[model samples]
Target: MVKFEYAPAPESTAVVDIAPSYGLFVDGAFVDPADGEPFKTVNPATEEVLCEVVAGGPADVDRAVQAARRAQDGVWSRLPGRERGKYLFRIARIMQERARELAVLETLDNGKPIRESRDVDVPLAAAHFFYHAGWADKLSYAGFGPDPKPYGVAGQVIPWNFPLLMLAWKVAPALACGNTVVLKPAETTPLTALLFAEICQQADLPPGVVNIVTGAGETGRALVEHDGVDKVAFTGSTEVGKAIARSVAGTRKRATLELGGKAANVVFEDAPIDQAVEGIVNGIFFNQGHVCCAGSRLLLQESVADEVLDSLKRRLGMLRVGDPLDKNTDVGAINSAAQLARIRELSDIGEAEGAQRWSPACELPDRGYWFPPTLFTGVSQAHRIAREEVFGPVLSVLTFRTPAEAVEKANNTPYGLSAGVWTEKGSRILWMADKLKAGVVWANTFNRFDPTSPFGGYKESGWGREGGRHGLEAYLHG
Candidate 1:
């Protein structure tokens, strides 16, 4: 095999203009909160301060919720389905027009590769709007009965892993269903959300139709608890999801929570070695494994486990883990210092619990948060690493002797978000998919997503779907 070297291809950051400070986006205007100081957002890769943003408090949440309520009752609710779709279409076009700027800003704040931010995140965000735009006028045919009604004002909170993409997932469907929204982006990655607020203004969307509040957990709590909010949607840890569930229990408000996962990627003895190796690498390393449904557990049939591990290791050795702006960088920086600390702690526990850890020969930068692609072998289902959501570029290797045993090991977890199977036999693919207790199952691939597919989880992975037609129904009551 020939080893090829490439030149540095860094993306230009001149495209995006970041102000020294920003305020809460409320009622189609930027306003200062009544209390709380401004908080600084930084580039995780360089530890450089990107910008300072206002920290919205309970009062701000109330104001935003009231704004959404006003929009839902006034302009947005009275607007016809076709007119609503026209607005969505306009927003979609504006997002595409500024795609490069959004992608660069996302890379600066979130520490994901510019290649991914440009190619995957921005494009998919626009796709969600485009996909949902077509469904706007035709929503009566969405199988929710003839006269499905909107849920008034939706209060949404999203995580930091895929900030822009998650916003698209939650906002597009809610808007398409005629529900105005007050959305809170995770404190760590709020730039793109703020930028989206500008996009809403550029599209000339009616006032109060979309509100963005920038804050921490307390702000999210306020939004979830606000009486003016008719619905709630949260994407984060299971602990927080449980709290949100309890907060809205037996209430008139509706809620959808998409939480954590410890997904398993199973490889059979008859699977193609090269493709399986690629799938295994992609499962746990893409976006530095920050995905909620990432394939962190690799279960191999014992008959060929050694050979598969060798191939996987060789492939990981070639992965480039460096500057996110570089087009050739395969893996990028961790999202934040706290997340990096958590990954380190869990990995140390895995080592202490008798797992053999290994990584490719690589040098890490000293300035910022970074983690090499790591794998632990001789791991069992009983190990904490196999059961926990590490949410970083870490893989735990486990082996089973039979198909029934594989099923047993995969289903032993508390999460049922997703699982993957790799085998050539069509019959085996169908059989294993049937046995896996997950919301989404993939054959010979992992981590592939689309706007047309419904994505969610079972068990502690949380409730309700977030894509396709099922996502639209989550915001409707009648």
Candidate 2:
């Protein structure tokens, strides 16, 4: 039989209309920052500058917070839940209408595969709005107590991995709860958020109800430390989360932080080998393993360790890593040079610490930030790679002799965001779920997310939750 291969199926970039430069989305309009210096956001795939965006300083943040507060007091807070729901529904519908453009833009800006951006990120974002729209008029039935009140203005900071999705996760719930917001998209991935600002306007959302401030760490710090913000929601590094926690320590503000994770994908000896292998690949390789809840730690039963490793390696060899715009690409570019350097640093340290590192034979683009799917077979709990969050397409394998040992090893890390278990036995699955100390536990699947399900973390991973009715509480008070 002749071998057949897919041709390059690249998505058209003509759908997205990017501006030469962008200003901060304040109140209801795009305005230049007061004292902020401008910076260019580049595509990590080719190191090409995409566009210049204003860096929001304390003054711009204050402006945004004041606008949000004014909107909360003047219009949003007084609006009926049914009326607010209509706005959210309109936003969701408009997002659906512009879904293709949004997906292509996300792939270009974020350097994630087009398929994932199109299928997962864009749709889930719209789903959040749709889900929250339905919940807006039903908050009384929610268990958060009757006569729930909006928190006025919420300050939100999101990471680069899922720009539009995180914005939807924060903004949708806050707006649905009748609160206005000031959102800070990651400096590297602000395109979609800026585009979403246009969507809010298209939906005829009231001015100041949804504000997006784009910049680097300093801007995010300003938003987090702003005095006018009644609630703070952040999704990023654990270090930043701790700082925000301290920033609001003595204030009247409430915060929900979704931080880092070093999750374990536990595979039992009785697991269906083929299915388990698939989950193993999906858990760590999806989004180039930039996921906060990525299963970077692979806990295999010693009995089937060799078999699983063999299968996993074979499966990884088949992963296609190339242009983000290509529909056939399984993996794409890393978000930035800094992230690539960090991944390389941790990977080198893993090798120095005596873990047997292995990667499939694959060619990476010379110009872009890329790392092949890699695994360290001789890794142990003591290994740095096994303990710390690599935040890349890297997996550290550790073996467990028994069920109890697997649970102990899985929960050993300080980060307790998520964990996965694969076993043929139903009793074993439940036992593992109960035993594992994590906020989200998946039994047979991995990297699965739903807008209606509440997601957050334990310990240093995060505080509070986002998604579902649980997410609304952070933006409201009884």
Candidate 3:
């Protein structure tokens, strides 16, 4: 067999202008951190330092919380619903205008393929604002009783995987519900959040309406534990989610967490083989499998297991693993060194635990953190890869003999975040959907997201929804 090589098709980085260092965005302005500790953010694709960002500490969190409270009590709370909606509309439009720049910046910071950031993340981020923008004036008819009030100040901590999109998920709804927010973007990916702060300024949004504090987990903890905050929204690890729950357990703080997952994508024997194979690849390999609700476990019916695995392997080989800026690249670099280490450790465990590990022949870039699209066969329910969330470009293949077995194996884990069912039989799809213990179940599809759909998890995957009408409940008062 002969291999074909293609020329590099890289997107321009000049679209994004990075400053030497960035400060915290508070009260409609960028301010230096009080404690003055700064951290450098890098491009995971090249390991080059992009810019220095302020490491927001407790004092910074307090200041942001106070600003949000002031906005909630003074200007933002008094703004009429329709007027509030107009602001969101303005934001959505501005996001659209800067979509390309934001997408490129997102790919730079998050190490995801430029294609995904441009096509999926940026568009969805804008859409989230647009979807909730319409709801601002229609809260009375939203089935949340008459005249639902906003939670005073929401503290939102988003993960690094989908930085800007997750920010949109938290900020758009909270603002639509008339709540003020203090958001902390993950330390590794703070540039886009700061750019969003500039967008807020361009929209002429009220000072303190949306404040962004950038830092690591400690900053998030401070924001979540801040007494001035009335609502706590987080998207990260399950351990951190549980900690947030405990911290706000007896308090009046309303918390919504979107955490980890070890999702199962079940392909029945009667399913379209080609479509199921594509779904399997998309479910696990998209975003380099960094997604929280990623279908990391592929469950194929025993009868069709060999055929599906062959098809899946062939498809995986075709995936481009290289520069994220290259439009043709399918799987990009891992988000960070720490994350790459974790993926390596987990993949090693999968091999050590007596599972057959396989990856297509692919050459990774020399400078960046890269992990090839990998899958394990002969995986049992007891295997570490099947049980734990590797959160990388890794998939575990398990076989089931019947529909009952598939359902049983799918729900066998502690996670109930998301699941996928692929079957030509509509009845089996519906039955599996009902039986699977997950918040979101996709029939004949996988990893599909929309601004108007409620996306979240059950069990240890976290609580509450982040999209649509149900998402508004998390930031509103009864």
Clashes of each: 0, 0, 0
* Candidate 3 Cα deviation (angstroms), residue 388: 0.4
lDDT score at residue 119, model 3, on the 0-100 scale: 96
For candidate 1, what is the TM-score? 0.99
**Can you give the TM-score per candidate against the true fold?**
0.99, 0.99, 0.99
List residue ranges in candidate 3 displaced over 4 A: 1-4
Q: lDDT per residue, candidate 3, 341-433, as tens digits?
A: 999999999899999999999988899899999999999999999999999999999999989999999999999999999998888888998
TM-score of 2: 0.99
Which 10-residue span in candidate 1 carries the lowest summed lDDT? 1-10
On the 0 to 100 scale, the lDDT of residue 12 in model 3 is 98
Give Cα-based local distance difference scores for all models: 0.94, 0.93, 0.93
